[model samples]
Structures are given as C-alpha cells and as structure tokens.
Target: MNKFLLVLLFSTAMLQAQTVVEPDSTGVVKSNDSLVVQKTIMRDTLKPFKRYKAEGVSAVVGEYVILDSDIDKAYVEMQSQGMSIEDITRCQLMGKLMEDKLYAHQAKQDSIMVPDAEINGMIDQQLQYMISELGSEEKVAAYYRKDNIADLRKDLFEANKSIKLASLMQQKVIEKVEVTPEEVRTFFFSIPEDERPVFSAEIEIAQIVVDPKITKQAIDEVKARLNAIRADIIDNGTSFSTKAVLYSKDPGSNSKGGLYTGVKRDSPWAKEFKDQAFSLLEGEISEPFETEFGWHLLYVEKIRGQEVDVRHILLFPEVSQKSIDEAQKKIEDLKKQIEAGEITFAEAARKNSDDKETRNNGGQLVNPISFDTRFDLTKMDPTLSQQVYNLKEGEVSEVFTDRDRTGKSSLKILTVTKKYDEHQADYSKDYERIKKLALREKQIKVINKWQNEKIKDTYISINQDYQDCDFAGDWLKK
Candidate 1:
C-alpha cells in the first residue's frame, strides 16, 4: 500500500483542532475572512447576561455554523457506518473542522504544493491499490456508478490529494523531531513493568509453493470458450459486465459485475492485469491470457491516463483428484518419517516442506506485529492462537490448513519454535521502545513551544462568539 493511502485510511484520529470565537457583540463580518461565526443557541439561554452582552449574536452564529455543517455531517456518516452518534458533540466537530481548515490554509500559504510528478506517482500508487482491492478497474467503476475507470481515477485522485497534502505537512513536522537513544532508554525505565508491551515469540517461515500446472490443452480449451463468449457479446450486444457476472470465476469480482476499485499501477495485480487491460482500446475484447490466478478473458471498457476499466472472466484448470490425494499422502508420509526419527523436523522442513516462507527457517512461524520468529500467545491468529496456547516447546502440531496473506488456502504443519510466557517489561529488554515514547513526548513539547510563540506573530482572528471558548493552545489568546 502507498504510505499516503495508509495514512489516509488510518490516521483520521490524529487531526487536532484550534478554534477562536468572537469576543464582543455586533461587528460587521467579512465574507473573505477564513473564519465565520453563526448562532446555534438562543441568546437568552446563556448565564451571566453581561458575558452574552459582550459576545452577542456572533457566538450563537459561530456555534450554529459549526454544528449544522461539519458536526452534523460527521455524525451522519459515523451513524451510517454503525457508530453511535450520541457521544459526539458540536464542540468536537467544530474543533476538528477548524483544525482541518487551519492546516489546509497554512499549507497553501506556505506554498506546500505537490508537484505534477509527485501527483502522478501518487495516482499510480492509488490506482494499483484500488485494482488489487476491487480486483479490476471495471468492478471499481461499476461499484461507484462510473461509466469507466477514467472517471473513477479522476475522483480517486482528487479525494487522495487532500490526504496526501495533510500527510506531507505532518511528516515535515514529525521528521524534525528526533528521539535519542538515551532518552529512549530513560523513557522505557519510567514505564511500569505491568504496562510494558509483552514481546511475542515469533517464527520465521518460508514456502516453496508448486501450483498444479494447467496443460496447454486446458489453456486452449478455456481460451476457445472465452472467444466464443466474446463473439456472443459482440453479436448480441450484451454488456461485458453481465457476461462477467455470469461467467467469471474470480468470485471476489464476479459478484460486483467484474468491476474493481482503488486500483493503482504498482499494486500486486498491476503489472500483469494492467498491462493486458490498458493494451486494448475502449470496447475491445481480448483472447484469454494466463495469470497467477488462472486464464482470463478480458474486455476493455474504458481508459483514463494509466488507469483502465476492464472486465475479465477467469477459469482455473481443475486439479485432478489423484494429484491432491498424492500431495496429501506425501505430507502424511513425511510426518511419519519425522515421527519415526528418520529426520529432524527442521531438516525435513528444509528438504520437503512446500512453504517457502517458513521452510528455510526450520518451519517456525513469525509474529506479524514484531516481524520476529517469536510467538506471543495473544498475538497469534485466533485458530492458531488457541492451538498454540496448549502446546509445549518442541511440540509438533497436526497437519492443518490455513490461508496466506492473500487469502490463498494451503495445508501446513506448525511446529512450536519458541514460547514466551507473560512477563513484565524491563529496561534491559524494552529500552528501545521506551526511548521512542520519550522522544515523542519531547517532540510534542517542541511543537507546542513553536505553536505558542509563532501563533501570535501570524495573522489570526476568531469571530466574537468564540472569544470566550477555552482552547488548549495559545492561538485563541492571540
């Protein structure tokens, strides 16, 4: 995934707000001003009439503007996504919107603009990711009610630009803040052992996967079938999407009429899928081509710059029952041999295990979080998590099936490589983690100091209503 996309997807919680309200009543408000006030509450509701007298209608108007627009929208969206809106308040929304607007304005004022090259690079990254997620541009466009992928690309690019700019600004701030080793160590020592993160025991695993080969005859047969389908599509004037929904074997995309979304050029499916899709002109249908998944019949619906909306029907060659039985039998035989002391598990895994990721590393599983060959019981996959909890060190597990990161299922045998019981964090073991925490604290202090001193020097004015609203930062005071 592109770093910007990752931030956009996960970093919404980090946006901070700085709001300023009006101090006194009745002044002419300017349309060009960045901040505006609207009344949300009745004037009679406020206590201490003198304070209300000072602030007047601007305070009420400011509150109303924030509530009606930003707060209400956020609440509705959150509720639509199954979140409770009861806890959300207008104040929170106002704070967030104000912060967002402030940062956006600052970026523009500072000339923090992404160049065309950067935009193109980001667009490519986003497109590939969307392709992988939605399986193809055709599916994406269909989902978004777009006529083609080009339209989808334009929308995605615009949506992602705001995300990218915000990230760029945040990165500039974070990069300048450094954490020293000594500070890291000291911070680690300060945290209570009970609160320290427990290191998970993980494993390093590899696999040497051998997909059941599809013969040339099978490929030709599938291709011939696809060609016939394409001919029918042309002659009958049937939509490619209708055909894909009926015939495509890619279950993930087939249900969505063979459209995919958020695809970028550098994604996993980008190279092979994109090359084939982009090669064809609009409304052109192609003969079957082989990809890792299977053989595919593709139809190009539209193209936008480097992005293409293409529908595809996939057909994976059937693996013979005999072949599957043979593979299983071989695994069973290997297990027997290991049990009978013919060879060590590590040696057997190195020689015979099909898993490339874990085989070379003696078939030990690694923790995804720590990226280490140690297992923390809590961090293990739920099924594996339960099974591993009961096993002792050096125990071999029953042959079981599991899916890889890409959701491809495979049969495997897990061995207990290492185990660490729950334990308190210590300076000796957790110094680096602690140091990072301390450094971040120090960085925040630096940022706060800068904000306090610099905000006064900058041009800032809050509407009269918000003048009394307490803000954590000194920008309000200015």
Candidate 2:
C-alpha cells in the first residue's frame, strides 16, 4: 500500500501492460526514490527511473514524460505483483502513454467533442460491469475512491475522451474492408500445419418461425383484465403482491409474487418491459402493456443506482385454435413457394419470417457459444436434434408443431443448410470459419499499418534515459 511497494507492483505490471492510466499514484513516491527502481531491475540493467529520484522528469515522449514519481511509483507496484522493471515493461509503459497522448493530440486537432451525456452513460455501463464482476458496488467504490458510483462519472471524463477519440480514429482507418471466399481459403491454408485448429461436430440450422397469433380481440381482453387488476391495486388499496401471486403466469417469478430483484439496466429481458419498469417512479404502477409473454402491469418497488426491483402481474391472451391453424397454414404455403422455385428460403425469410433476430440474417440459426452459424448435435434439444439428425444436407423437414424460445406454440420447418463433421478445419468444408479468420487478419493488418503511419507523422521524444533501451516499436523514433 505504501508508495514504494505500489511503484514496484506497477513497475512489474508494466511488463504485462497493467497500470498505465493511474498516473496520479506516481505522485506519492519520493522524487528520488531509488529503492523500487533498484529492486525491480537486476543489477546489470541501467536504472532508467532511478536517476529521477531527485529530478523533474523520468522519461519524455514528445512533450510527455513519465515523471520521477510516476515511474518510481510504478516500480513499487510492479514489485508488489512479484514483477520487476525490464526493458520490455519500461518500453510498454512509455509506448502506452505515447499512444494515449497521440490520440489526445489528434482528437484536439480534429476538435472532436463527445458529449458529456454519452461519456457518463459509458462510465455507468463500465461501473455496472465492474460491480457485477467485483461482486458489489461497495467493492467498486473502494477500488475507485468514490462514496458512490456517480462520483466516478466526472473523474473518468479524460479517459473516456481518449477512448472515444481512439475509437473514432480506428474506425476511420479500417472502414469498408470486405473479404471474399477465396481470401478465406488462402487464410485457412496459410496457417502452420502444426498449429492448425481442429473443429467439433457442428450444424448450420435454418427455420421459418411462426408466432401463434393472438387475435386483436384476445389482446384487448387481456389488456382489459390487467387494467381492472391495476385499478383494484391503485384505487381499492389492493396489494400488487397478492394479485401477482395469484394471477402471474411467469413460472420463474410467480412464486416470488412476480418480483424481480437485482435487475441491471442492460438486462436481456424485453426492452419495452425493462424501459417501462425503469421509467416509473417508485410506488408508481404502469398501465397494461404487452411484451412477448402477454399483457402486464408493473409496479416499481425500488431503484438503486443502475439496478431495479419490480413487481408485476402477468397474463397471457387466450389464443384460439383457429389462429394457431392460420399460422401453420401460412408457413405451409411459404414452404410450397420455396419448393416451387418461386422464392428462395432466404428471400421468404427476409420478407415474412416472424423471428426478427434471424429474419435479417436469412433465418440461419447461429451458435451463440462459438458465434458460428452452426450448433453441435450433442448440445441441441434431444427431440429436435433427433428429428434433424436423419435428414440429409439441403433437405428441409416437414412442418412440425414446436414452441419458440419465448414458449409460444408455433409451426416451423427446419433445414440443415450446412454440416461439418468432427475434424481439423479444411478449407472446403469451413468457408464460414475461414472468412471470419481472414477478415479479422485483414483488419488487424490494416490497423497496424494505420498506427505505424500515424506514429511516423507525430512529434515524438524519449528522455535520454530510455533512448538506448530496445522498445518494441519505432514509437519513439521520428
């Protein structure tokens, strides 16, 4: 916790690219602090930071330098992490700061202005993620020296500005690059034979998803029923909890009287419901609203920072057999059109599919785990996987009754457009995989080229302390 130890930890972490941003911590070290500098480096290496023990600057890059205190403080923190200063770490820290200042310089020249509101929202998102990762807001507060997360908003302003500008510069550098299938094959074959990755059994699935339609009359009836329940709670002093326990159909929350706790702002729940829930003042009851489940009335119970707890009464619309048959019939017709060569499956999906997520992507069911347009048979639903297992590639299954992810009963037709067996990747069978790999390689190459070009144009300087140390890039050389 002391300055000397903190510097050692940071000094070691610099080897791993860890503590470059918290420059203020360096101010705690003695101007001539040689203890950590001596400790971090072996007796052979020149003590670049130790000379600053009594001086104004440790190392300079263009107009920027790691101050004596900052560099030495980093040395102590590096020691704490069981690391020591070396040419690589010293270069990395200096490189990181130089890159940051470069972005800062260019962003100022461009007169870029990322609004405070946007920056604050990003800060909140970061804090929320940290809170989730660290186990509590209190822990995050302790880490950041804030009594509450809100205090962090203004404090991270400069960091956010640098982040935004760097992002903008990166986008400008790598916009509009595209890769083709041949490029994909080349990229796959270029991999070293010994390092080639093997792949698992996977499938590419497609479907025509139909929503069991809820007629307008059924929707109105559900809404009317929810409104009456809300009236009883608001005007008659009835408890929201009692009505939720008795009427809510959501199995997950009904046992708890439909109360959801520790709900973060960016939850994966339906956007409309989450937005309305967060919009309400505490003790306010929302009017009847519909989500994927059905109609609902929500009452905000508590709000804490970016998290919320809410109680709701949920009701499903009465879906008639006629509506179900109509959905099935329409899908049957769509299937016939595809079979008759009147429309492609992808065209039909784009124009008429009910599932929005896959509709835009031509109905291919992408594996969320690997981000592949495939799924492993072992991981798939037993019943559905068995039904799909016997089918050959390019074969479409008969229309079958199934429930969508939202648990709505509907009819769908499945297609296994592509299939891959368990093996090391081959260019012939894994073009999708190759395309992604090649595209990323191209993007990375483009970014590196952009960075080198920018570094060449920028005014740069390094203090004599680090002038002779071998750094990774020509970052310091004009």
Q: Which ten residues in a row have the lowest lDDT in candidate 1?
A: 25-34
What is the Å distance of residue 475 in model 2 from its true position? Answer: 9.7
lDDT of each: 0.53, 0.64
Please provide TM-scores, in order, for all candidate models, with all chains considered together: 0.64, 0.52
lDDT by residue for model 1 (1-478), tens: 3333243223222322122111111111111111211222111122221110221222121112222323333343233234444443444444444444344444665678865544545455444445656566677567555699677656545433433454455445556787777777766655554555554444333222222334567667777888888889889998888888888877656876776543335433635676777678888887768776667877776675655666788766655556556666766676777778887778878887776766787666666444556555555668776555666666666666665432444556655655555545556665654555466566556645654554565555555555555444553654
Structural RMSD, model 2? 12.8
What is candidate 2's CA lDDT for residue 26?
13
Residue 13 lDDT in model 2? 29
Q: How far out, in Å, is residue 271 in model 2?
A: 8.5
The most accurate candidate by lDDT is 2
Q: Write the per-residue lDDT of candidate 2 for residues 133-176, one digit (tens) a residue.
A: 45555675655556875565444555555545645555555568
Off by over 4 Å in 1: 1-159, 176-181, 192-221, 235-238, 261-268, 304-307, 333-376, 403-408, 443-478
